[model samples]
Every structure is written in C-alpha cells, then in structure tokens.
Target: MNQSELRELLSTEGLRLLDSLPAWHSSDEIVRTIAELRKAGHSPGLVAAVLSQSKLRAKAASKFGPFAERMLFTEAGLEQATRLSVAAQHAGRFSKAGVKWVADLGCGIGADALAIAALDLNVTAVERDETTAAIAAFNLAPWHNAQVVHGDAESADLAGIDGIYLDPARRDARVRLTNPADWTPSLDFAFGLAERYPTGIKLGPGIDRDLIPDNAEAQWVSVGREVVELGLWFGTVARPGIRRAALVIGDHGTAELTAAADSEDEAAGELGQYLYEPDGSVIRARLIGDLARQLNARMLDTSIAYFSADAAVATPFATCFEIVADFALDKRSLKKELASRKIGTLEIKKRGVDIDPATFRTSLSLKGENSATLILTRVGGKRRALLAQRTTFAETSAATA
Candidate 1:
C-alpha cells in the first residue's frame, strides 16, 4: 500500500468502515461492495484501501489470530509476520532469561513486539519501512509498554535494552534472498549483537549449517507438519551445553529433543512393525539418532531418515505408521498390489527417491474407496515400497509402553 492508501486507512472514518464491513469472503462480493462504497460517496482510494485491508485481514488470521481483526496490514508485512504462537515462545525466552527489556529489530507489523509487550516487558519494535512501522504502531497501541521505532533496525538506539531479537528481511521485491549478506540488517549484524547481549535471531528453516554460529543454540521448530523457523539464541538466553534442539508443536502437544551437537546415527537394522518418519525439525537439527534412541528405533537405511522399531511407541518427534506389506520397488508390482487391496485413496510419501508423488499417483490410477500411505524408499541398498496405515492418537497411546 502507498502513502495515499495508508493515510486513508489510518483515518478515523476509514478504520471505522473497515471494522463495520462484513467478513470478507469471495472476490465476486468485492464487486458489489466496491460499487456500494463508491455510491456512498467514499473516495476510490479509501474504498480500495479498506477492501484490500479486509481481504488482508482475512489472510492474516492464520498468523495473527484474532488480533488480525483490529490490526492493519501490508501484504508483505503480513507475509513476513511471525505466527503469534511462535512469537509467544520468543517472548517467553527473554522473560525466562530475566531480560527486562527487548529490542525487536525488524519488527514487521509488530507481531513479536506484541507478544513481548503482552508478557508485560518493555519492548522497542523497530521497522525500516515507514508504512509497516505505522501499522505496527497501531497494532501495538493496546500495550502501554510497547513502542514502535520508525528507522533502520541496525541504527535503533539500544540504551536500556537487556536483550535483542532480530528477524532480518530475507526478501526483496517478494523474491527470497538466499544469501545472508543480501538480507536487510544482515546476519553479520545479528551475530555481532549476540556477542554483547542475550540475542535471539530467527532465520529460515533451511539455512546453511555453515552459516550458524558454533557457540549459539540453534533450535529448529515445527508447527503441525511443516518446519517453520530456526531460532538462534546466544549469551544468557542460550541454554548451557545445548547447541542443537528440535521443538515440535503439533496435535500430540509440544515435545522437544536437545543435544550438544549432532548425535551419531544409529546402525541400520531390519524393518519392524512400526515405521517412524521424523519431523522436519528433527531432521534439520540432525537429531534423528537422539530421537531414534529415545524411541528404541533404528535407522532403516544409513542415508535414509526412516526408522523402524518393534513397538508402536508414541512420540511427538515423528509420525508412526504400522507397516502392512512390502513389495519390490516397481510400478507394475505396486499396481498389482494396490489393485488387490482395492486401494483408492493413496497418500504417497517418499525419501531418497526420484518419483514425483502427484505424477506417480496418476500412473497408479487409484480408484478404490480405501486409503493407505505408501512409503517409497530404500531398504538395505534395495529399492522397495512399503504400504502402511497411520496410527491414530488412541492407537499410538495404546501401543506406548
């Protein structure tokens, strides 16, 4: 949004209209609403700005929760905003470290600052973009302790700051910048701050391992099925002796696995009744061996992450599937096996394989009413397909012991 649209959206009338509008749904409804607003004598700019905000608010709900209703958003700001649940953890870290004040650098739309302030801590939310700063200021207005700084994050005055949180903008013109040097505020600047104070840096899950500072605690977090962010903590906030951690937040509840460094991989062993696919965070943190040991499971292959165990152990770090049948890794065999079972619903998963699940699904021509998960992988240097059924929470609990 430009300055003109921003000005209109920030106006008293504009905000009132935005809150008064019906919850946004389809684009077809936009046409009629636009016409109605135009007939009501609202300027084209105001109508466009409010409608856009309404639409953005709908999309922002996934990340911001109910706060999206009262908050203003820029498309890019909303895209980069941290989920409120994750932000709460960031705040809890600073609080647990006994840090009284936090400087949330690169505070897009003030998501982190909101959480920090909600914890009753003094927070300085700094944003380089003027429009985003204004939106953040508005979103954080509910908190008396939160303040927004419209300036360069690197230049933000940190006079009384007890700790700092940095989330550098890793995108330019909506394009992802893989190189840390290209990121605004730069990873170097973030690492430099870590040396002086309790610092927390948020980066993409797939960041190069070499870029991670050896002394900092690198924690990879997954919410539901996807790995979301890698948080690097330093100084007092960094837990002692813990250099790597995998935090899993999912349907089973929150579970964490931590280690000093990457644990040695367990020896590849025979397939058991249960197969465990480690969560992405566990895989990225390279804590598979540690998790496997906890579950009494072993790697099914040296290079593959899949694990096999005798018991149906329930753990948040991985999804457990009961292996039903195995077949030679070939389409003809799979077709015949699938046909015999009358399998219609196929949840195809793969590791160390070249097949594309979607395109391969078409090849199988599944049409049965039943559902099953087909794991295409390697076992003992041989390609094979394993048909498995997902263990429900109840089944997993029953098998746990």
Candidate 2:
C-alpha cells in the first residue's frame, strides 16, 4: 500500500480508521499514520483525508486541500477567525462609501471577503492555496456576488474591481512573524494596486513610518484601546494627514471615530484643574495636538501623552479627569497612609520610568478596601504617580489611529 492506498481507506472508512490511530499533536504522528495506512493498503484520498483531519491540522484539513497544507496553524488566522469586528472595519471602509466591486487580495479564510459581501459589495477573493480557495468559496456560498479565485494575486487579472483591500500574509499560517516583512504584501504589487484604484493595505502596528509612501495616507487603528492594525490608503482615497481611528463596542452598539493631524499651538503654563488623556491611536497619530486645541487643553509634558487645561471642552478624543490630588514621590508617607487604610489593591501607572508595576505594588504593601486609579510617571521632569478614580467623563474612543 502507498499514499494512494491510504487515501482510499480514509474515503471509504474514515471513521473506522480514525478510531484505530493513537492521539498525537505532531505532524510526525500524521506521517506515521499515513505509513501505517499504506501498510494496511488504503487509497490516496483516504490517506490525504486522514492526514488532513489529524488533530494537529484538523482546521486546515477541514478548510483546504493538500496545497493549503502549507498554511499551517497561525496566530493571524486565529485573529482573523476570531476578530470579525476588525475585518468588518476593513470592509466598511470601502463598502460604506458605495464601492460595490471589491477585491480582497490574499483573503485568508475569507474573513474580510465575507465582511465586504455582507455590506452588499461584490467581492472577488484571491488566494494562492487550493484548500484556502475552496474554503473561501464555501464561506462565501451565501453571497452570490462573492467569488473565490485560486492563484497568486500579484499576477492575477483585477481589471474591474472598483476598490481593493489587501490583507497581506503579515504572518505565516502559524502566526509568528520571524521577519515582519516576510508576511507583508509585495510593496510593488501594493503600490501598483493603490495606483490603480481605491486600495487599503492592512499592516502591522510595528510598520516603519518612513516606509509609508508619501503619496499614500497612513492610519493607525486601535480597537477597544488595543492598537491592532495599521492601514495605508492610496489612489483616489489618499490624503495628506495621518489618520487615527478608534472603535468602541458597547452593549448598545459600536462607535467608530477617525481624527486627522493638527497644527495648533502647544498648551503651556500651570497644571490645569482637569487632565485629559487621549485614546492611544489619537496620541500615536498626533491627533491629540488638534484634539487639545478643540478641548482647550494644553500639553502637560511636551513628550508625555497626557493633556491638561483649565476648562473642559467636550471632545471624543480624550477622557477628562477632574484633578483629584497631585503630590511628590514620598514613598514612606504614601505607604503609611495606605497601610493605615489597609489599601491592598494598588494600581500603578508610570511614564518615562522603567518601574515595574508589580514591584511597586509589592513595595507599598498597600492593604485597603478602597480602590483607586493610579498614574505613575514624571511630571515637569519629576517622577511621581497619581491616584484617582474613573469619572463619568467618558472619552468615546476607537482603535483606529
């Protein structure tokens, strides 16, 4: 018996064969099982199915054929599989503006493809693996306009697509990016696509700022306070300012926001009565510079991410905090005060210093029933941490920067 024979066994008697094999996690076990099936005289399809269905590769096996085996299990796949909201965001960017013909290049698992199709856009999804292509087809079966094509996208004919969304293989199917560039879409292909149409390329947060083409508009995106993916928009959609987007999902619904760059004068002078902290994406995109002006807030520290102003001007970018208490670093005094109150739950936040929150929590030996939000960082070139509680003043924020 050979590979052909083993495959036959699986097609004709898959359940029977599965029960007889020992459980294992390694690909080696699958190889060994194939060998055993061959010795027992199985068919090629049976062998293929069995190997593909092995626990180690069950998902890939379920979704793809042999060619897709290279996809392997990966973090990116898991993220794509689990984070439907993120994919929907990518899709919404194009679909919301009435772009109907969308191309989802490198559409792994058809996550973004499904999202675009759900928005009533006709999508052409291209994948390099037969298995992944097949799986994508199955995933898009409900959408009449969603088609999955098997091939390399770089050379694929994409003449009619009105808008293109590219989610490059930022990581191997196993999801670890040994070299970040290894998973990125080819720069030439990406730029070409952007030059041709309204295109968005998904990128890792660690992408170099300098690498972004001057003609393209770059955005930093964060979802739920976690900076997830960066996006580059080109062609007709490109703009000059950096875009920061934040997404907030709540019980009622979802809220998304995008803030562009600002050139307002920096706020100076004394610490105001209120402090505002912008969303991470806003801070990263330097949208806070504009947001501060809108909120009438000034920078607390030139380099610090926090903002301060005398009056509160309502804005979505920053969360306003009524200044509760500000003090210098008096470890002994603070510890004694907390110890007397039996403050056990200590929250430490710091900027500029390499202090570990855990060590500080331990050192304080704070044991108290009262809980407080702590800010640990340098203020005006001094090292200190502030303690406060969350206020009703919510900074409706998103994850896109």
Error of 2 at 179 (Å): 5.9
Best by TM-score: 1
Tell me the TM-score of model 2.
0.72
Q: Report the poorest 10 consecutive residues by lDDT, candidate 1.
A: 23-32
Off by over 4 Å in 1: none
* Residue-wise C-alpha lDDT for candidate 2, range 121-156, written one tens digit per residue: 899999886656665675687899899998887767
Judge candidate 2 against the unseen true structure and give its global Cα lDDT, from 0 to 1. 0.65
Residues 265-345 of candidate 1 have per-residue lDDT tens digits of 999999899999999999999999988998999888989999999898878888999999988889987988898899999
Model 1 lDDT at residue 92: 93
